[model samples]
Target: MATLLELREEPHWSYSALNTYLNMCSLKFAFQYVYKAESERTAASLPFGRAFHIAATHHAQSVMQGKRMTLPELHDVFAQWFKLECAACTNLTFKNGESINSLTEQARFMLDALLARWIDWNNIVSVAHAFKVQVPGLGKPLVGEYDMVIKDGETTSIVDWKTSAARWSEGKAGRDFQATAFSFAYLLEEDHGMIPLFRFDVVTKTKNPSLENHYTQRTKDDLYRFQLLALAVERAVKQEVFLPAETSFCCGDCQFASACKEWHRSSAAKHICMAA
Candidate 1:
């Protein structure tokens, strides 16, 4: 019975958080556990993605509660969420000269396409389902809010929504840590030896929006890999090994880049003084 505030204060591991640690340990450690110096910045595509998820979750919940919404009503809901999200985010900017109005229109198109393809809402067992499971070999519980879980007799399907400009590949779905973790969590909860089908419903943000469904089934090996990853992350945290990872394209958007650079300069200066 952990409150949202308590969960935020507690140390927990998630797929995105662990990926952040792997991408740049110093940045993840500073942002997650230490004093966060930089303001959290919203990416340009986040508003649309958030709006899409909100709309989708609302629709799913309504259907699950035996009150399905019409397509037009869902579209209006998405529009309202998109408008509010755009107004709240002051730093959102598009590289392609796309304004908020234009993005909203594109999101509408995407929503329409998504609704057209997502006609199987009747199969959903849970929407925005929250779960906390103790992963083996990890100290803290892994918490996640799944988008949708569809149960068909003995078989189960996990649905994740994605709003992106490009369609996702099956290979990417297979390698996705979030999908692997969700499957593991679901298995732990059900204990049903059933391998759930993971589906990624991607809505593209193009002039003419498109919907792509990518499917992946997590094997025991995948779950083992995730467990190993979680164990390694826990060990790193205990050992205080938050070293800066090698520079990559992700460095361009890193919030801790300035602090990391300053620390490097100070270390180099100290070494020079000692050698002199």
Candidate 2:
């Protein structure tokens, strides 16, 4: 099976992309996937979350191999990635006095909380496992990675790790489209009769970090609805119907803020004016 990076080379959709289109903004998606505009700067939180994710991936892989990392070791893992990510980032934007050092402290605290609540089950099936689902009527496939997959007794679960500044709200997991799409992908690709459980392990960022697990399940009807949504998004993308969600909360932190402001001016209009 091709890795997620390899799968990404071809035209495809993922939970993140769909979230950007549906929840974030469509013009942002067009700026990214269509116009291929480069972001002026990388947000500080973006790299911080990614570094934490990479560190968590390391921890999960170690657990799968039956050798969980110690707290200091895990902190070291996170620090290494955070430093590397920050160095590579161009024009890293920081807000509210956030710096590399501050984020590192937060990562340490979050990891400590995570290790304290670590479950001892070791029936690891896959870590950072990638999957590609082919939906009918769409030319492309939906490709993504399952952070971790494990079996406890007869029940199998797909686990995703997340680091957040605040605790997740009630029923947020149940409403997440990622869980729905991931559950749908697992069913189609694995051909499992039983619905695989979807779980999110979210760690909050604070002086005293906390870890919480939220579980969600998707049924056949949910999967059917998800497929229909995928088809609709695909149709919209094909028609080049991308538009800005001006009132979106995400606009404050949008990467394409500049491009969005200039969206009203088009090359076609410029050419027409010159001809006149």
Candidate of highest TM-score: 2
**lDDT leader:** 2
Q: Which pairs of residues collide in candidate 1?
A: none
Candidate 2, residues 1-276, lDDT tens digits: the string is 888999999888888888788878888888888788888778888888888888888888888777889989999988999999998987889988889998898788899998999773577788889999886666788899998898989999999988887899999999899999898888878566566999999999877889999999998888888888878877878766677799999888888898888876966335445655
Candidate 1: global Cα-lDDT? Answer: 0.75
Q: In candidate 1, what are the lDDT values of residues 51-164, reduced to their tens digit? A: 889999998888888787777888788889888987787455665678767776776678788777876656888777777778998998887777988987777889999988
Worst 10 residues of 1 by lDDT: 264-273
Q: What is the lDDT of residue 223 in candidate 2?
A: 82
TM-score: model 1 vs. ground truth: 0.85
Off by over 4 Å in 1: 1-9, 23-29, 66-68, 87-90, 190-193, 266-276
Global lDDT of each model? 0.75, 0.85
